[model samples]
Target: MDTTTNALRWVFLFLMHHPDIQDRMCTEIEGVVRRDMIPMLEDRSKLPFCEAVCFEVMRLGKGSPHTAPHTMKQDTEINGCVIPKGVPVVFNLNSINSDPEIFPDPSTFNPDRFLTGDGRLQGTEKMATSSMGRRSCMGESLAMMELFLFVMALVQRYKIKIEP
Candidate 1:
């Protein structure tokens, strides 16, 4: 619940800060979905820009800054440094999400980064916002769906503006 709420909040805040992006999203939504009708799952594929915005929100929000502490099961080497078994390791998701190498201009709220040249949502395997492997977020799909629906609904119906 918190994850979804935070994602929505960040999305709205970003939209308010970047009216140009918000207008682009609204234009995209209005192109496919009728003004009187709410967006549905079938419309998901048609809204690549909206999907990118949602991904950017999650990336910039860094809702879960660190994963649950994981203990080393065996001796391992990372970047030539040896890690012994039983050592606790907390993956810094914020660092990964903001890494310049992975996300160019990491601090900027640019949804286009998530979009391909053809305007499709690129796979998020490298984003690392959602923890990877066995302990990854189980609610990832649900959260994404909720974020998409909520964002589409909000942007379609109103103009988001920042207050003084």
Candidate 2:
């Protein structure tokens, strides 16, 4: 789908532009993941920086510009705007990802945003994107795993260099 492919493209582009971040990702992946084996869900936690890169892709990249339409079961109010029950509403993911409060200097592509002061990967509890939430895509979990593995596979196997 366009969403998944766009995520890959964005990840590559971001890494290409930010080799320091890419190097950190590779270092993290190499530290925990074996070169001969493909990464698995169990490896997700050990590879914090890799997971952070994937998270950054979903957050900073416009993987899915907007969510699918859904009708609310109960009247909902967001920022004083009311959407009565039975009304279809679509959320723009970019708006959520770019919230100044959630992400400072949102324009910059920084996977470190998902990390803590000590460089530990922050949990995903507060991470929100088009594919995450109650009404999220059915393949949310699988897609997230795929994103992490996809990036992990690449950086683990090859170095991404930007040709001037």
Candidate 3:
């Protein structure tokens, strides 16, 4: 759990310092949500900008760089690489997520890529954070929901700024 905890802490600290992201996130929240109403799960679909920010954060955030381990059940080929059955596989999420082919200019933190021309999330489905097969992480839903709420609450409260 240390890996997960440290990753989350780092992400929190990074967001706290990044004024551009904080300003954009707050503006998006303020535009969609009334000040009086607390953000809820129902608000998620209506808040595409919010979702995009969260997606960008997740993409950039190295939360749990070392994902939980999994063992291969049967022989499989992925990306032209073949593995025999019963081989231990460590899915380096960091590499896959930050790969340039998958995310252009992967090292740069940009939220605009996730948005459509009209300022909505471009993807129809959430990207998978864990393995697709039988050994996928079980906490996917819980983690996503928690992260979303935490970010929304932060936006609702603080108007973030960079100290010069």
User: Which candidate wins on TM-score?
Assistant: 1
Model 3 alpha-carbon miss at residue 40, Å: 1.0
Tens digits of per-residue lDDT, candidate 3, 1-164, equal 43344435644665767767777777777887899887788888777777776776667776656566667789999999998898887877788778787778977867777888988788524344654456657776566667677778877887654466
- Choose 1 or 3, whichever is better by TM-score: 1
Which lDDT tens digits does candidate 1 get at residues 1-164? 78889998898788888999999998899899998899987899999999889888999988999888889999999999999999998889999999999998999999999888999889567776668788788988888898889889888888888778
Model 3 reaches what TM-score against the true structure? Answer: 0.80
State candidate 1's TM-score: 0.94
Q: Candidate 2, residues 53-81: lDDT per residue as tens digits?
A: 88888888877678888888999898999
Superposition error at 15 for model 2 (Å): 0.7
lDDT of 2 at 37: 85
Q: Output the worst ten-in-a-row residue range by lDDT, candidate 3.
A: 124-133
Q: After superposition, how far is residue 57 of candidate 1 from its true place, in Å?
A: 0.5
Per-candidate RMSD, Å: 1.3, 2.0, 2.9
What's the lDDT for all of these models?
0.88, 0.80, 0.70
